[model samples]
Target: MASSTYKRYHVHGYDPRQHLEHYASDKPDMAFEEDVLKFPMENLAKTFSLGHIRGDVLIDFSASCMIHHLYAACEFFNHIIVLKVSERCIMELKKWLDMRTGAFNWGHTLKLHREIQGIGDELPDKEEKMRSAIPHVMICDLEKENMTDPIVLPPADCIISVWLLDNVCKDQDDYIRYLRKCSRLLKPGGHLILLGGLGMTYYTVGKDRFHVFTYDEAFARKALAGEGFVIDDCKVKKRTAMCDLVDYKASIFIVAHKEK
Candidate 1:
């Protein structure tokens, strides 16, 4: 586990609504609009568009309660099992999944994704589709010997992690160690789509600032290669929306498949 002195998000303390308000808001100038929002969604759309990422089960290991990134992948996989580290994030995701009152409005995110897909008219229907694609959202810890301990998850065809490693890994070594854990969940030759920040050291939600593991593009490629994943595609977008809320200068999206 990460040894940072700051309030780590790996625990049960993450405030999902606060994080949503800070990063997932559709406000015109939200600081993380590019890094935390569009990068993953856009890249996901492109990756799935290539017609190579289809499978029976797609496991999502992401940060926060945000659901934007999964909109594009719903059609490619039969079922999506979201693994969350914190109960708070799981509860927040449930609130949205169950369509309860005051669930964070993911409509804007869906709209953004559809716009990227050129299927701008798909709103409420597509929203429901994404919800149906995801049938399970359970708690799991990457630090655990069996990330999905009690429930033995079938080896996934694909795994997508968005910014979760930034919060869970304390350093470069922790990054590789946790990555091996993630790989173990995959079927051999399965895909791994990772989205992370470049040179990002911290992100603030509400009044608390959480630590982020700082790494560059080279380190990312090296780590994935070292862990037996062959890099298929890697894309980097320089931080366009600048703010003090986060320290990342750029964001990265990589599509890799585990070697059989």
Candidate 2:
């Protein structure tokens, strides 16, 4: 994979609305969205519903402005904190929190989440529940000395980071380094639930292809174990359909607890 050809996620300014429509919108022809977004929501609903990994606070460390996965999360956690690298993402998130006009509708994703849990259709009041649980959306730098910058956040009971680190890290070493950084945010024995594409090189968004840090299941396990996390559960979703816009062999979801 030529790293030069792919754009860095932090360097490019993404249209948060465009991105949501591309992957999370309810379109019949969105094959890539069907695989990439829905798979994670299914895993999260199943995993969190097991009643083992949840707490008072959960932090979101995912790429793009997607919060559909967190719909299941708000049910378990008391407060949700969103950490984003882009100002555009922060603003878009706030729009949802405030319930402004034109905010990307997460209704379809919520429907999928409810479906995965075998619950009845229609989440009442849509995302008002999730929005109520989220108290803050702050700017974070994955590479900064303090990822949250200047403000050091209180250690969280759990952190749900999906599809963020893979795009932020340039290589395997960087991946491990970022894992350690994410681990620092959790209290001792706090869980870190992560999701990412496996063996993926790049995914296109509106003519621009963004880089994906390629790694396999074994490497991910080793990295987490090396960073003081003990694996509690792991789930993999093999690629369901073939597509050129998105490339990946599988998607990995892990639930691991930090061991001091």
Candidate 3:
């Protein structure tokens, strides 16, 4: 109900290891690799390769300590800025970026990305690329007027947010308002890439449960349109795995452009 509640869960209870092991594990049944990771990677690669999306600076709004979704974008953009809501999340990400002792190994995710791109033979160093591309990881509050306040980041060429809005917003209206706030971080005609869980109410991490705002594809389309974004592409994947750990019905990915 309150924003503090959401922050408490993530800042205190969120475990990067548990989050990665549960969702992005090498397990076959986990739809996260195919539905969440691979789909977005391929879409970004293809878009960037075909010259559909062009940008020098790319900003990720939901960095969440996961670099799998960012592998493709690094090839096209020179500068990448990752924004997180919780300090714990920022620390987890820095652990990896700094190559600390307990950093979560993302080799499996990088391997999958290389396979999808058909670059297994001549794979670029993904970890190094990610570390070099992402120079800043700062705190951001979606409800605020300037997400990266005081710092005053330049408007990004593209913004990416995955599974962030539903977890943070209290309802659909709140979600839409947050979406508009995120859009302000982008330049006019800049792209917005979003990945979210459809029809999900809550998810479990370790022993604690967190809330999610549920909505369908229809609602997503209308919300993006209302926020002055033109939907360039949208994809939805039905859930095949039935796990009590997470109760999402489907995964939705959208690529939208802010209207000039």
Q: Give the number of the best model, judged by lDDT.
A: 1
Query: How do the candidates rank by TM-score, highest first?
Result: 1, 2, 3
* Tens digits of lDDT, candidate 3, 7-86: 33343548867777777777676656766677677776776677767678898877356788888888888899998888
What's the true lDDT of residue 100 in model 1? 96
lDDT of 2 by residue, 1-260 (tens): 46688888887867877777777788786676556677777777788889877788898988888888887788888999999999999899888889899887777777677778777765676488888899889998877878997998888989988889888889999999999889989999999999988998988788888888999999999999999999999988888866677788898899999997
Superposed Cα deviation of residue 245, candidate 3 (Å): 0.9
lDDT comparing candidate 1 with the true structure: 0.87
Q: Sum up the clashes in candidate 2.
A: 0
**TM-score to native of every candidate shown:** 0.95, 0.94, 0.92
- Which stretches of model 1 miss by more than 4 angstroms? 1-5
Query: What pairs collide in candidate 2?
Result: none
Model 1: per-residue lDDT, tens digit, 1-260?
23255677886366899889888898776777767777888889989999988999999999888889988899889999999888988999999899999899877777788788997684668878888999899988666799888789999999999999988888989999989998999999999999989988888887777888999999999999999999999999999876887778888999999999
Alpha-carbon lDDT, every model: 0.87, 0.85, 0.81
Query: Which 10 residues in a row give candidate 1 its minimum summed lDDT?
Result: 1-10
* lDDT over C-alpha atoms for residue 109 of model 2: 75
Clashes found in each candidate (C-alpha, N, C closer than 3 A) = 0, 0, 0
